[model samples]
Target: MAMNDGMSGPGSNSLKGITFLLVDRNEALLRSFQETLASYGAAVYSVCDISKVKDVFKEVKVDVFLADMEATGQETSALIRSFRDSNPGGSFFLLIDRVTYKDALSLIGPEADDYFFKPLDPDRFAQTIETALGQSRPKSNSLAVIEPYVEQLKPYLIFRSPEMKQVLMNLPRIAASNQTVLISGETGTGKEIVARAIHVLSRRAEGNFVAVNCGAIPDSLMEGELFGHEKGAFTGAHKTHRGKFELADNGTLLLDEIGDMPLSLQVKLLRVLEEGVIYRLGGERPTAVNVRILAATRIDLIK
Candidate 1:
């Protein structure tokens, strides 16, 4: 079916840039599932025939796989094994009714990432999918406790030094909180990577992760870059523009090399942080925003 034809639904655009492959014996159920995901800006390819799954996989790269356990029957395990062998990175979720739920219990193995009951609620399904995609790594208390959340950071960070470990030890706690963070480290120390890891681990992981280098852009343009501008706000402003804060609404924003920002810009940033709103250049009203800020610097302001 065609995906995302301007349909409105819960968590609008939350699944943007995501792809799904859905399989089921019932065409109605398949269509419903496709429409639900498509409404959230997902590219969905659904098929009622179990045999056509391989052909679909060959044609498209799928991030998440949803299959009806009743349709697969005894071959469920083999199908999951084959899919995982070929696409180890993809996530697999099973769909089953209450009647088959008990029987399907045995089929839930390492290959299946999760399962959803039939007659799925769209909001819950979307939320669950977002949560699963956000927490890409498998859950393991051993890594979070014994190893100090190192497993979750493996994809973004690689460190062996005790000092680095000590720095990372507080990562989980910091990520769980909603407060702003200041990541201080010398240049080339992977402060950006650490910021990315924090964003990935935070509650806003499903939202956009935006980063702006304060030192790279000219000071004259910094205000417009952060607070955006209305159409005709300036000689060059022909169209309305969204700033970094607007773009990162409901997500995390990393201000890299924050120490380089001019004092005037810092005051404006502090105002936005305190008020949770921004005034576009040449605009009269304020636009509220929900963003988590992560600032990185090579210089120590504290000292």
Candidate 2:
């Protein structure tokens, strides 16, 4: 259904500067919706193929994603999961027709912010988007406390939520300490970005910040990846290789997805953390590393 081109009354530009991505198979609906949102001063972009959503996300910082669940078909849940994995910060709104409203409602959990039914009120839809943006906007008081840090992180992180501001408020104190920190949150929630911010605020700001994804490395090669290896230590160990620990000496080492590390390697990791020394593979002597360790995990290790 297409919306009329009637000019909205005063306060019509409530969505000014807001970026929106609309996903729907119906071209006519997309054009009308895009025009309505654009009239309200929103930068609107539409896509028919859900597969191109990720590409658009990579190219632009989308403020909100309005997706047509009916058009998305059976892959809606999986696509939403992928969106959360890649851009957990962006707001997601599902557009469902009356027939599948209940089914779409089930998809609105931590990942989705809200949902709207098909044949939407153009004014109401624009107002809803503006309201969501307003609610997530950071309060002045909270922003004041972390303004400097936020400024420093502008190039690396994009967040303006009170929850994130609260998290940032504790960063200064946390960065001052030499103790190891475990940052736990859902996937793509900017754990790595926080780790980098800590490094930037800490005394090790001048030193290198090295990050290693514990889950990405193979189990067989994980040990050598973290502790380095001497020449001929393994089949492909042609020369002495420096591991993440040594590379981050006098700096910060972020072990991302730490929960994925193998149990065998965890023991060694504990020893290294306690001793501040690493015994490289096939090496008799221990190498001391003056690196601060920051661990990030998506899983609940406490459980």
Q: What digit string (tens of lDDT, one per residue) describes model 1 on residues 164-277? A: 665565565566545678999899999999998888766577788999999999998999999999999999899999999999997899999999999998998887765678
Q: What TM-score should be assigned to candidate 1?
A: 0.53
lDDT of each: 0.76, 0.76
Overall local distance difference test of candidate 1: 0.76
| Residue 186 in model 1: lDDT | 95
Over 4 Å off, model 1: 1-151
When summed lDDT is taken over every stretch of 10 residues in candidate 2, the lowest stretch is: 1-10
Error of 1 at 146 (Å): 7.2
Pairs clashing within candidate 1: none
| Model 1 / residue 208 / CA error / Å | 1.0
Error of 2 at 56 (Å): 64
Candidate 2, residue 23: how far the Cα is off, in Å? 66
